[model samples]
Target chain A: MEKEERKKKVKEEAKEKEGRLTGPRVIGRRDVLKGFATVPFLGAFAGAWARKRHIERELKNNLLEVVHLTAEPADIVPVAINSKPLRLGIIGFGLRGRHLLRATGHAEPQWIDDAKASAASNRLDTSYEDFMNQEDLNVVINGVCDVFNIHAEEAVEAGANIFRQGKGGKMGTVPKRYRTYKELIASPEIDAVIIATPDHWHAPMAIEAARAGKHVYLEKPMTWNVPETYELVKAVKENNIIFQLGHQGRQTESYIKAKEAIQKNILGKITLVEVCTNRNDPNGAWVYPIHPKAGPDNIDWAQFLGQAPFHEFSLERFFRWRCWWDYSTGLNGDLLTHEYDSINQIMSIGIPDSVVASGGIYFFKDGRTVPDVQQVVMEFTKHDLTLLYSASLASDRQRGKVIMGHDAHMEISDRLVINADPQSTAYSEKIKQGVIDPVVPIYSFTPGKKGIDGVASATEQYFASRGLLYTYRKGRRVDTTYLHMREWIHCIRAHIQPSCNIDQGFEEAISAHMATIALREGRRVYWDREKEIII
Target chain B: MTKNHHLREYSTFQALMLVLLRVSIGWHFLYEGLVKVFNPDWSSFGYLMDSKGIFADVFKYMATHKDILQAVDLLNIWGLVLIGAGMILGLFTRLSVSCGILLLSLYYLSHPPLAGLQYIFPQEGSYLIVNKTLIEIIALCLLLAFPNSHIAGIDRFFQKKNK
Candidate 1:
């Protein structure tokens, strides 16, 4: 009886010890699950922190004008104009302004449907209504600033404030009214001026407008040279007038999103950026449509050559202004400034340290000053970044903006395409032989144990055909024209700088100007930011 | 071993044929396999089903699940390098050919029908699985028939050299 009792006691002790070690298999499964449950919580916390950091970085980098101007809602005062239904004055009644008016008027709402029709088009319509509802403007002046006179009737009909005069100043006077820029800038009735004039006239008109305390929307290539650029900035600051640079790309929602993605490190550390704008014909060289009747009768010749050496009022020079070095800064300031401004806003990289370029007028020898093919390399010191800009008037191969980073490459176009480098087969072979096959348990898994759920075995067969791991993140497409324009207008109302403000515009202009100088001088030109010149 | 008795010897003729066939098959495998092993830019997983339009969806999914593709790539490289070397040398002749056949068969099955049957030729009327897999399968058959050890091979050399 005692022996039986001892055997029972021994069996019971063993059972208790086993229970203590294994912790009741059924109950332990629950505890294991409980421990696993906290994993998601920790993951969520890390994800949120990462997201917060990205948001903070983006906000800091973005030159948000409204945020800088107003903190309290009550401090914001809506501008009141004399005209009913909110007047919009567009000073530069040129090609850009006409397109702007057409886009803002017809496509503003209808563009939404068109974007939805095409998968590649970005969804820019979501914020379009916000622009119309944001503020009540008194007038948007349509000024005569482009190479050709943009019909002011369109602005007038579109419910905008139009300030325009005939080609020969004050309705066909032999010389042209406003021959001296001071007369054009000092027009009292005009509430504001959009300085979309020639490169030389840009600074003088802008400075005068700022001096007159009138809001100004100055087109790109902010000034003719570095000294004038400084003077323009000083004048704007001193007068405390609402000044916005016409680097309209900053207003693009797609660009803004790309910038946000970069600041978020979605692309990791950006090392190289490539921007290419190419065309197959001479028209792409900015030799715009020349009217059959283009002459001194239709163009203000003196104003067109303002501040620059006076030349004969040739129709070819007036219409194809971009092809000449006398009026336009050729390929650099004419086209490159727009790209440079957009890129600076996107990558948040300041002025480049050095710039080198090589280009020649090889293709279009037809009365053009700029090269048919131009390639510029810019090196930035602040972030160890390199940017290359290639523009051609001959080739049609378009390799648009590309931002290469460690993780992925974010390419901007009508739609954004983020891609990873294709895996090397030789490297993969080595990994399979040297590392993965030996280490990964999943790789070597075999059909051994059967699950309790009564599922069939031979599970290893399923694991044999698996491929490598990679992730792709793509955003919804969105157009930027309306958004960029709206952002500019909003900045004006808030008394803050626009997205592509004067500083960004000047830097881009300098970079573009340097590229031209490099090509012209047959030597590399480095940007000296402190000195503000091409060295 | 007289000259007249040699005329009736089927074994000698068979061995001669086998030797010639095995050497030829081994050489082909070695040549193809070595090139893939040494070439740096070769990638297997990157373009499994890359195409325009809807085909992009297939490639995108394949791109995400790459481990298996990677393993297969490694296997192919080694199977060509080591097995091809072994077969060509006739050191582990039968074993090398078997592995080569196995790898070729797996690749054949991965993308069946192997593009088109039309390859480089004077348009000979062909009706067979004449892909890399088929070549390997034929090589394996030839290897099986070969008296690689007794015939001209390193297996015999090693045995003789050591002796």
Candidate 2:
């Protein structure tokens, strides 16, 4: 073995010496700079190239607007429950919290038959007035909490069905209000808690709720920053409690089908996935109007500041908290998390190896800190996959989410469509047999319709429908948030893991923070697996 | 003209000519890429918007979709730099030239020289379905085809050493 190795080395050295003599021995460095001289040469001539084509600025603009190719909500697994009703305490009865409450049980009194009648009446609806009755869900909104007395009052009032005032069923009673989340979570009457506080308060409140032996149904983003992400997940696990992250899009039907396609390897070595958000409306962009009743009196200014920095009572900051970095996680946590978590749910991608994000506060210059436009690229090196997320607040162009694989690509927007790649090796056999045609898609699924079932603007509802935020059953519509809340309630009683459970929530928190850190610091951020943190 | 004869030796003028072509193309890529890198406002947005000829929708799509548009912007900028640097330095000739071919081809296809499409801007020269992008692609093709051309490059020094 040694003799053979010695012989190989001698032959290699001889080849190297021969190689040196044969090639140019002294190539001038100046000769290389001659290459750079072509810049102006190409640049000058490329003009003719640019000018040769007629400009269609508007056509280009029309093409570039955002798309809404999101999937519809999944049907709740129909199962009989023997356990008694679970008491659900809700903290942060802000806009999203109120909606969650309505979806969970508030719309039980209403039905899909009403939405059809409303749609027939030509009313633009975006309310949770039509979801199927989750009568089997063991949940009662017993405790309501918010720093703002008005929000708390509205949350409690939201439970009032005085129309059925004399009836002795679920609609008869209303939840008691609390000023602080601590007071609400500590209550012995509450069996589980739904937290929809500001981004900063999520982890602190979730950790406290877990310690108090309450199951958690936290809203999107899951946590504010990196340490909070770890601590919250730890608390949930250590307490052995069921924790559901509010990426209600997990119930999206196209997402479920897409996940099935991925598990089947129908796309074959999936590589790149792109998800986007585009909204032209003011409310959609996070400049939510400051309420007329908002003030330091009705709102507890100090307590609302919870884990965030203290600021003098500013209604704009309180109502439009999503516009600031101190109280929010910007686009990554606010909007991109939806796409990220949805894609994560389908692909089962835990954490990306690295995240590189870029954006600016383009268009909406309304004293807001978070960028109205943002883009994030996440690389899962182990899976050889890349997740791309782009959000634009100024534009209404709907660039839907698309996942590209070697054999095919799955697009989740108006429908779930899978197209065979013409050059795919995996599909070559089927292609040769004329079984797989590139001209036609291999699979297509349209789960829900573009419905204005609830009392939101057509634009806002378009952005919110399970199809984008509102979901549909047989000829009737349901809310994705309701379906999500239903699954959590069922899982809580059955002692089974919910769809967007604690571990998935942890991965999502880490992923969103990775994007946040990357965008904020203007650098490439990597997940240190051993250390369980982004660096 | 025999393949075996050029393997041992080549004329000095021939080596200079080969190096010249390599350096010029390298410079073109590097300079174009670097200019865009330094200039934040620089984008292919105009080019994509004004795209005509075959694959007009492809060009328009690239211009319209933010994700693809952003990617095209970054890839076009960085890809030019890396491939141009490789060509000039005579490192990874095959890999660099291959990438250059693909990039130039995309550019060529984006707006072909097909007749009947006219615009208001000043055009340098007129040719039927052929232009500078195509010419550069041919130049890159020549660089890739010739193994001995790399003798004028640093790749010669580390040619056998690189794994």
TM-score of chain A of each: 0.63, 0.77
Which window of 10 residues has the lowest lDDT sum in candidate 1 chain A? A446-455
| CAPRI-style class, candidate 1 | incorrect
Q: What is the interface RMSD of candidate 2, in Å?
A: 13.9
> Model 2, B24-110: lDDT tens per residue?
788788777776675454456556655787687778667655568779989999999898777766777678889999999988887
Q: After superposition, how far is residue A95 of candidate 2 from its true place, in Å?
A: 1.7
Candidate 2, residue B34: lDDT: 70
DockQ of every candidate: 0.02, 0.03
What C-alpha lDDT does candidate 1 achieve relative to the native structure? 0.55
Task: Estimate, for each residue in A140-230, the C-alpha lDDT of model 2 and write its tens digit.
Answer: 6788888888777767765554232222334547788876788888999898998998898889999999988899999988989888777
